[model samples]
Target: MKAVVIEQFVSNFEDLKPRDAPLPSSKKSSDIQIKVTHASLTHVDMLYAQGLHQNNKRHVKPPFVLGTEFAGIVISSPSNKFAPGDRVFGGGLGSYAESICVDEGIVRRVPGLWSNAEACAVGVSGAVSYGSLISVARLKRGETVLVLGASGGLGVMAIQIAKAVGAKVIALVGDKEKSRIMKELGADEAVSYRQRNWEEEVRALTDDGEGVHVVYDAIGAIESALKCLRYRGRIVIVGFAARGGKMEEVRANRILLKSAMVHGYRYGEDGRRDPRRTEEVWSGFLNLVEAGGIRPIIFQGNYMGLESIPRAFGDLKMHKVWGRAVLRINEDVEATKEAARL
Candidate 1:
């Protein structure tokens, strides 16, 4: 099998590449064996490669496969809920490979309308966006939301999810093109942080010209995020992708003035701690998918095979990718072709 193994933490994305590796061995009876057809490359993957992710620093070590979200066909299943040849999409580590073994609890059948690539595109980021807005922030219908990093994978999903719940969405992006793209994707309005007075522009889009009801800050713009919040508004800190991989200091005085609530969003860790809550959040997200309120916004790139991982990471870092960048692996393979490759 081919996998992107992080032999040791490197400072550059180019230093990460794929290598021929042994097939994964199942660790438990509940683990489902999947032949990965498509996988989502995320910012966290790059962070892991650079030893900057909290998970990497705390637990995960070198010589590990790097990816978390995937869509594939089941090679075998230990339970009746899934069977051999069933099309499924789910999330776990070691997805940047030809196959992965994940517990049945984390696996889900791919939604009817989505392709393998599409399911791969939304698997984890969708969960994060849905969890942050609907579960953590308690976003309500008729409320207003400002989604930072609106052109990125999570932000794109956040915009659509907020809209599906009847909330007005204001996307805060990096440029004019991203602003246009966000509006086309269901954001009620779009503001570019590149512009001077961008925070004021965001505030002016709100119902009362005070501020938005909720701010989904994925890009470490907490200071500006606070400025764009309404009284008693909710702010969900999803990530610090913009802060050069360092933590940001939030002013307590800002939180005090508005009587605001701030939540540090960590979907994966929260899911591990409370299984029931995970189920509820995932169910709500899938329901929205089934209702056609959400769709995968895949980057326009032919990222095929394991070899493309490095280039994908580079593009993601350069902001060349608009939405989730998917790598197609074994998607169109025949049994003979698979055998021939081996």
Candidate 2:
């Protein structure tokens, strides 16, 4: 099988290459093998290739596949709950391959409403957005919520999820175009963070200029988002897309003054530690999708053969696209079979 293998730590994306590798072996009765139809790229994938993640420094040596999420058809199932042709969506490391073997505990059956592309894009972003707003943030109806970095995959989902939870959502983007996109995704108002006094604009849009009750900061621009929070508000740190490495310095007096709480969220860790909680969050997200309350935003990439994957990574780093960028693998696999056939 053809796969994108990270053979070395490359400073440039183009240095990564596609290589022919053996297909993964099927697991015993406790595991299942999926024919990967689509795999999507995230910033974390780039970081992993560059040896930025903690494990990459020690483990993740040469000749390892690199990817975290994919949607596919079941070729073989060891459990009674799944059949050979069942469509499923799930997440796993080293998914940039033709097939993957995963524990049945981590995979979820898609609900026949989404496409393989949508399912692949929704993996970590959808779960994190839904879980942070509905669970960690404990967002209340009629409350105001702010989504930082509202144009990215997780940010876009956060905007929609906050609205689905009955909160007045304020999406913070970097420019007017992204602001418009956020508004279309159900944000009550969108603010451009590039503009001066954007924090004041966020405050003005909420009730009585008191700021928002919950702030979802995926950009890691925590100081600005923190300053825009209301008294006794909660801030959910989803990711550090904007600022990486080293913690930001936040004043303790400010936390004391506002009586605010800061929470760090890592959906992957949570899912690995507590599978039931992960399933519950996924159920809620799918229910909202089925109810027409939220929709996945996808950015399509050209269908390239398995050998062209290194270029896809380059395109991602160049900011040549937006939303979720997916690669079609296994031309024999139907694009609709993974998510739409559920």
Candidate 3:
């Protein structure tokens, strides 16, 4: 099997190299074996390659697989929940190869409505968006919700999910183009934070300038997201997409004045600490997809073979790609269907 292996942390994507390795063996009873069809690159993957994420760098060592989300078909599994040739998608390790092994507990069946690429795109961003809105944020019907970084993968999903839950969504992006995309994804209003007066614009957009009921801050810049929140508003920090600087100063008096809540979420931590609850959330995400409440925005890129993993990581680092970047790993049944249609 061909895999992309990172021997050491390097700033350039060229540091990652493609190497041939033996195919992964399947577990006979306890684990499920998937013939990987597509694996999507994420911002966190770039950070992991750059040795930025503290947890990813600590747990994942060199000569390890890079991809975190994938969609494929079951080749073999002892669990009755899946069987030979069952289509499924979820998050796991070593997904940049032709096959991957995952525990039966974390994987879920992909909805028939989605393509292989769409399925591959859903697990990480979709789960985070839905979990943050429905689980962590506890968004209420008719409440106003703000989605920072609303054009990225998680942001796009958050826009749709917030609307699905009956919240009026105000999307914030870096540019007008992304703002347009956010509106297309179901945001009631899209604001670009690039403008100097954008925060004031956000204040004016909501009713009585009361601030939004919930702000999903995917961009980790603390001050921008915080400043936009209204009194009693809650901000859920999911990722730091922009301004990877040290945490800036936030006035405690502001928190006291608004009586707002600041919360941070790590999807992997939440999944590990409460596997059953995580599984439930994952199921809800799939249900949303099935019901057409959410859809994956796939930005098509070069369909490189296994050898191009390093360059793919490089593109990710340079922010050259948008939405989900999927690499096809194998000619599984679903992939075959997609290819035939194409």
Candidate 4:
């Protein structure tokens, strides 16, 4: 198998190179062997490579495979839930390879209308959006929701998912171009955080000049978003994309003034702690995708083959990625007719 192996954490993504590696076999009865066709690139993978991700620092060691989310065809499954040639998409460690073995409990069938690249693109981000908006914030129809970092993968999915539930979405991005893109993606209004009074502008865009009912803050802008929250509103912290990935501080007074509820959402850790509930949420999200309520947005860049991984990582770090960056893994891994129909 050809795999991108991280022998040691490095400051540069260029140090990550492909090597011939041993084929991975299923270690658990519930595991399924898959031939990966495409994989998603993310900041988490960069953090892992730099030895900066909190979870990686605590649990992972050197000499491990480098990626997470993947879409592929199943080669074998012990649980009988999936058969050979079935298309599936899921997230697990060691996905930057030609093949991988993952637990069936974590995998889901790719929707009939989706391509493997699309499946790989949304595998993790879509779940994060669902968990943050639907599970944590309990976003309701007709309520106003504000999304920070509205051009990134999580932000793109958040906008669509919020809109699908009938929420009026206000997307905050870095510039006018991204703002326009978010509006086209179903945001009711879009604002550039570059504007000095963007927070106030967000509040003014809400019904009756009141604040938003929920704030989906993906870039550690909780303090700024606090200025745009309605009374008894909810703020769900998804990530610290700004401040060089360091967390931002929010004043206690602002939260108190709005009578707001603030939550730090980490989908991976939460799912590990409560698998059953995570499974239910994931199942529901898949249902939403199957019904055409949501779709993955691939960044408008050409990323193909294992060698493109470094380029994709560079784009992600530089904030050039508008949506998910997907790397084509095995060109020959085609979808079966039966799997494509379902």
Candidate 5:
């Protein structure tokens, strides 16, 4: 099998290269063997490659697979949750190759309405958004939410999830184009942070400029978003897209005056802490996708094969990716269907 491997942490993404590797097989009866069709390269993947990821579940020191989330056809399943022909998608190791072995508990079935690429794109983003907003943040129905960096995968998921539960969403992005896309995703209003007085603009969008009930701060915009919160509103710090999550100072009086709640959320770490709850959230999110309640946006510009990892990584690091990016790990997902029919 051909797989993407990183021998050592390097400053350059081009340092990652494809190598002919031995095929992987399931070591446990509860494991799933999948023939991978598509995989997603997240911003976290970029951060991990650069050794910027601080709270990663695993250290990933060197000589490991370079990718995680994947959509694939099951080759074997020893549990009742899936069968050999089930089309599934989820996050796990060994997805940078044609075949992968993962614990059955981590993978989930793909919705009939979604393509394998879309399934691959949603695993991390959907898990993170739904987990942070619903499970961790406990956002209630009819609440107003401001989703920072609303154009990226996590941000887009946050917008859709907020809308599904009847919450009004004010989407924030770094540019006008993302703002447009956010509006198309059912955001009540979308604004670019680059625009002057954007935080005030966000406030003006609310009734009496009282700010939103909840601020889903995935871009680490803690300080500015503080001004965009209503009294006693909650803010969940979900992502660190700014400055590699460097510690920044915040006015204690702002949070004090508003009587707001501030919390940090990392989906993977949360899952590690509580697997059963994470599974339930993942299942519910896929159900939302099946019912036409949410749409996972994929980046058309960065959709490429495994051969394009370098280019895609470069684009991600430079903040050129506008939405979720996917890599088609295999060209023959339809071929898996043919086998299923037989």
Candidate 6:
């Protein structure tokens, strides 16, 4: 088999390389062998590659295949839920390879409306957006919501998800073009955080100028998020992707005064701890995708195969990708199966 291998913990994304690897076979009765067609190539994959993510670092370590989200055809299944040739998508370890064996519980059939790339495009990020918006915030129809870092994968997904529920969305980005993209993606208003009064602008855009009902914050700008939230508003902290370790303080008094709720969400972690909730969140996200409430914003150049995976990491780190990036591991996958003799 062939894969993108991280041979050691490194400071550079260039350390990732295409290499020969042993094929993975099913070890458990619940596992299924998948012929990988596409895999997610995102900042998180970069983090995993460099051993920056704690759990991925602990489990994957060095000399490991690098990937989580993937879409593929089933080469074999131990259970009746999926048969050979069924198209499935989900998160799994070592999915960067031409093929991988994963527990069937982690994967689900791709909806008929979506393509292989489109199905995996939303994989982990879409679930996180769903958990943050619906599970944590309990966002309601007609409510006003604000999404920070609205140009990234999670933010773009958040914008569409908020709009799907009939909520007016205010998307916050770092530049004018990102703001324009957010508006095109269905955000009712877009604000540039580069502006001096961006928080105030967010407040002004909401109904009656009081504040927004929910804040889906992906950039970890906790201070600014607190400023624009309405009385009794909920703030769902998605991540600290802004690259700063030091964050502005959150005043307990502010929360007390406004009756605010601050939630720190990590969908991946939550799913690990609670399988049922994980199932619910993933299914709900796929249903929404099938219903056309949202779609993956994939780019062709970013879908370069395993050979250019190192470039994928570079593209993400350099901030060159607009939305979630998906890499086609083996578009024709038949060659992969032939090589593996599965």
Tens-place lDDT digits, model 5, residues 82-173: 98778898887667787899888788787777778777778778878887888877888878899987888888889999999889899987
lDDT tens per residue, model 4, 135-157? 99999999999999889888999
Better of 2 and 5 by TM-score: 5
Decide which is better by lDDT, 1 or 6. 1
lDDT score for candidate 4 against the true structure: 0.86
Tens-digit per-residue lDDT, 1-342, candidate 1: 888888888887776677889999889988989999999888877787888877877777887898888999889898798877777888888999999999989988888678788888888778889999998899999999999998888999999999999999999877788778888999999887878988899888888999999999888888899999988999998998766668888888999999999999888778789988888888999899889999899999899888888889888888888888999988874343335546
Best by TM-score: 1
TM-scores, each model vs. reference: 0.95, 0.91, 0.90, 0.94, 0.92, 0.89
Estimate candidate 3's RMSD in Å.
2.8
Q: TM-score of model 6 relative to the true fold?
A: 0.89
Better of 1 and 4 by lDDT: 1
Summarize candidate 6's per-residue lDDT along 180-241 as a digit string, tens digits.
77788898898888789788888998879999999998877877888999999999998876
Give the TM-score comparing model 4 with the true structure, all chains together: 0.94
Candidate 3 per-residue lDDT over residues 1-342, each given as its tens digit: 677666676687766665786777765467888888888877767776676665554688775677778888888887688977778888877787778888877687877787777888766788888888888889999999888877777887888888888999998876667677777778889887768878778878888886788899887755666677887788898988654423457777777777888888888888889887787788887778778898888767776667676767666556555567777777456756456556
- Work out how many backbone clashes candidate 3 has: 2
Overall local distance difference test of candidate 1: 0.87
> In model 4, what are the clashing residue pairs, if there are any?
none
Best by lDDT: 1
Give the distance in Å from residue 63's predicted Cα in candidate 6 to where it truly belongs: 3.5
Q: Which model is ahead, 4 or 6, in terms of TM-score?
A: 4
Q: In candidate 3, which residue ranges exceed 4 Å CA deviation?
A: 26-29, 243-253, 310-320, 331-333, 337-342
lDDT of the candidates, in the order given: 0.87, 0.79, 0.77, 0.86, 0.81, 0.81
Q: Give the higher-TM-score candidate: 1 or 3.
A: 1
